[model samples]
Target: MVKKTIHEINARIRDGSVNVVTAEEMVNIVGELGPEGASREVDVVTTGTFGAMCSSGVWFNFGHSEPPIKMQKVWMNDVEAYTGVAAVDAYMGATQLSESQGMDYGGAHVIEDLLRGKSVDVHAISHGTDCYPRKVLDTSLSLDDMNQAIMINPRNAYQKYNAATNSSKQTIHTYMGSLLPRLGNVTYSGAGVLSPLSNDPEYLTIGTGTRIFLGGAQGYIVGQGTQHASAGMFGTLMVQGDLKKMSPDYIRAANFTGYGTSLYVGMGIPIPVLDERIAQATAVRDADITTSILDYSVPSRDRPVLRKVTYEELRSGHVELEGREVATSSLSSFKRARAIASELRDWISRGDFFVSMPVERLPGNTSSHAMKETEGVSFVSDIMSVSVVTIEKDASVYKAAKIIMETAFNHLPVVSKDNVLVGIVTAWDISKAVSQNKFDLVEDIMTRKVITARGDEQVAVVARRLDQHGVSALPVVNGGNHVVGIITSDDISKLFARRH
Candidate 1:
């Protein structure tokens, strides 16, 4: 049994005698010396993770002008910021897109530009008040010009995150990244063995007021993150740091093709080895941590878990799913993560940084639950028409056109011989086929990548699918992929009309 205290660790750090090592190095040290011996020798273990954190933002106060206007609307580098707090203070979220540049530029870019010493155009509009009468303001400002610039992230440093793969035939662009069709690729985030929360799974040394390395600058943990679920193994942290002191190398901007923009944050946490338990926790390996592989193709609040795999398998550049080998990739940079941990380790060894015990431990055994809607709410099965008109993929285009004209339905679901949904055909597709004089099989003119809904899904989820894909209808299917019914926009409109 070995025991120490934060006071002893601080004294050693101040005297430049603290023995600090990165989490990656601690693994080997523990294997050689055991947890008790390692606890006696290692004073602190440094951990790091670098990846896209969407719930991040910067809040700044633009010093009042001579004709100070109470900014009601604000834009930095053409991106909007929330200005409901004060006269000139505004908070810019990382995912907000630019009005003119769209996804090419965003709030994350503005924050990175400010860190790089670039001047951004600042424009604001305000109602003329008695004291502050200026109605408009247009100026150029730098990070130094702001009275205070602070990065307040709502959530960061996920303990362990699920891997994502798509089972649909069409590729999907999401915040998780672009998932290839049919589980062609698997993408996971987090620095497996070097993640901050992974080293302190129980939040023993990392909690409120815990000092941390945030974006190459010192930061503090504020409180529990928004969606902290310890029981689910998806814990998070809320942190704040000085934006002016951050380095561009540690704070960068990124865009996910169709998923707007986000900020790539470099963060590190140092855990004090107060006992053998703490040392053992810090020495966790990738193979010891496991996460579920979730199907991202499902458009709902709850997605099906494909399987559970350890980080070792996920980092090997491939994973086995249902006997199929799928290529793997990492959105988080492990190289930068190692660099961050090494930098923190050097800072502690040189007496430039000291570890502190948390004021209060974080909550444990908590779980996140899905939002509950009103009882007896409508589902796709409630609003869908049971008499679904379908056509075989091998049916003639003339036959599909005849069915469409007779039923007055614009869309027809194309199914396989086993009565499973395979594709869909529209009136326009049949018209084009007839005009082009290519009245071939329905499979030739049908859309292979069909968007579908499940009978058990909520109506609102199905409605979002219809709007997201710009389609007018969806075929509701069963667990076996059998088309049970069809839901259309008209059915939703009628439901809304009756409810109101």
Candidate 2:
């Protein structure tokens, strides 16, 4: 058994004698030479992934202007940024929407624009202070003007992600892209065995302080990513890099039609083939990796898992689902992923880059649990009245008034013909209608912007909404915005009275 260390690999890299191969190439090399032989022949294996990571963002320190202001709220290119840290520092998340362009232009676009050497409009406002008295600052600058532009992403490079499919009748727009109705198609977003985490499934060489290729720039892994659990089939990495050194080709801005914006980051990790174990891991193929196909049509966090399918099946362009062949597609670019891995391999073979051992292995054999409410906690559905009285939008105001007179209820949910909640009509609106003698339609007198609650909402949140809106009642709706029940201030009072 030829046992080597990362130090040995670094020495080889420095002496221009290192032998490197990509994860895909390792599969073929292992097939020909076996694990032990491959480990002795190959010094390192490079892995890569190019996918939409919504958790990505950039932090900036704008050089202060004359009569500097303490920036409390900031916007770059009309997209809001968090300015809670310092007077001239702000962090803009990629998914944040633009005030003027909404989903069309967002923080991701601003980040890419800055990277592309374009000028960005910056506006900041602050409450006048004694030390920093200036209230507002508006200027245009490029990336070269910033003191620092660091990309500190909380989560990136998911080891494996569930494929998405919709079983509902209507198409749903999600981060997974538009899932066609009735599982018309499936969309996945991982690079299979070529992925960084997939090549180092045990977090052996890939950990905090691990040097990586990020957005065409040398970067480092900061720590374990959010929602990382070693016990599950999924894992993630938290990484950071200098945005100033990144390239537009490896880092791009993307906007899903209805899912706002996310950053497409190209990342690669070099794994030192220290022994047979490392070589065996790097030889993982698409057939060995498996993930579930989750129903994205379900609104809840615990979406229904349709079935387990291998990456090979997903890459084959279709998969069997409910006895039908569902077309499969990848949201992550395999072509870009292969290019990134090849780039990293070349960097290592040319002695320009070297792999490093992890400072400490990431947590392993740990399980994550779904959020569960404590005992005695109640949701709006627990106390809401199931027998809800609703009126159609096209109904007459006289009919609404008659319903209010006949029943003790003061509010009626105005719905469409398909029973979708559109508005709400209160007795006060009906009284105004009667006084004005304007009995045209229920929708004309109803409040179109109805304050509503979801069935899954906690009672405390619903109470706050009711108090904030100063509304006596709220129509409880489902995911489809169809009113299923009604919760009122009186009902909440009754629950507390009973508890007492």
Candidate 3:
């Protein structure tokens, strides 16, 4: 076994004097054990609260995705302990808000889209309810619904997300197969309305500890961006979250990083596949790290031993793992409605929140606002309108209504021959026009006093317009008052949310 105790390694970390080593060199160091004794040599790498500590004498000071410059030598024990504590901290400190309330879908599974970007987890059971082709379901879960929820139980880690396919299969196979026990009280199983994120290293670190690389300078999540990047030993592709971005090609080419080198990369096979290449370069065999758990299919990994769990081990079979205490003791369906309703009632009783998402970057070059303005040029003028669907002012409201039906836009500008903004039109307006259907002349029914802004206008003004009118969109007009582009409330809301 590695020499130092977790406490000793932790003390070194606390003192800012821990000796750190990377998987690159660690793998080399472990190679001495030969492929025969490899599994026994691999340390139980912990994260979140637990900091890094090697099974050997070396202090492995590290955590997942810490870039270089910020990364320094520390005992692996220290790093493991830190992560373990951090995870505990997150769980402990998370307020018993709506998320902590009651709702049990036996366990959860996270679905990720490795290429375009990460997709949010959708509960396995809820996935079906959400994508139900039957359409008999009354409602869909909102973000607030998800936010007020908690990760109440143990769950499976998933690979992909096909909303429709999963939805249908879940209802027919899993929910029906397993849920018959609950009887006819509108019961369903799998994951509930929300799919909580699975950050546990056991589920997330598919490439193993050394497989992930943290190149360049690593730092904290709140600030600090990743600097340089490359693949390393154990097929590791380093791209720390703190880094600005991770490059695929850089990871694709590199095999061996230096001893004790840090790596940060996206989480996926390319990472492990790369780590395998690096391991070959480093003369590290697969047995050097992989464990012979006998049956890799063993479930309920939080325990010390690996074994297949039977339903008989479960109390009530579908017991609400951890967060169930509150779900039963504290909340009733009436209580749930009241709790959320209380929020709405409080807002009603108190007042309203006038949130704004200006198109320009926040005051301090923050990425909060999706689109940023140049030094002088306005965001509106620079925006190139694409996939635009237009309708003439002379066209009947029915024609305008049809445009919105076939296309995605909810609003369009009423431009005259000179391309001047004669009036503003929207689906809501078209709906009103259709309802009224008073006249054939578009001008007679057109909204004459439209809320128009100059092309040079600030996105801040656009944000303000949305709030004042309680409207979903606005049109961008040129200096000659010609409609050049359009901005919608959705864009502003999404931009603002991303920036935050």
Which parts of model 2 have CA positions greater than 4 angstroms off? 371-500
User: How close to the true structure is residue 120 of candidate 3, measured as C-alpha lDDT?
Assistant: 32
Tens digit of lDDT per residue, candidate 3, span 1-500?
Answer: 22333344334445544333222233454367542232233221111111011111111111222111222111110121111321111111111111321121101111001111333322111112222322111222222322221211111111111110111111212211211111211121111111101111122223212222111111111111111111111111111222223222211111111112111121211111112222222333213222111111111122122222221122122323223311111001222222222232222222221111112211122121234546443344444354455556787777777778988898777878777888877777777767776537566567766775555555665677578667776677766877777777667666566656
Candidate 2, 1-500: lDDT as tens digits: 87998889999999989999899999999999999999999999999999999999999999787787999999999999999898899999999999999999998999999999999999989897888899988999899999999999999998899999999766878999999998999999999979888888898898999999999999999988888877895778899999999999999999897788999999999999999998999999999999999998766678899999999999999999999899999999999999999999999988888788889788767666787757597889899999989999999999999999998789999999999999999999999999998989998889998888888877877886689679999999998999999999999999888888
The runs of at least 3 residues in candidate 3 whose Cα sits more than 4 Å from the true structure, single-residue gaps closed, are 1-378, 382-387, 437-439
Better of 1 and 2 by TM-score: 1
lDDT at residue 74 of model 2 (Cα atoms): 93
Whole-model lDDT for model 2 versus the true structure?
Answer: 0.92
Residue 487 miss distance in model 2 (angstroms): 8.6
Highest lDDT against the true fold, candidate: 1
Instruction: Return the candidate ranking by TM-score, descending.
Output: 1, 2, 3
What are the lDDT scores of the predictions, listed in order? 0.93, 0.92, 0.30
Candidate with better lDDT, 1 vs 2: 1
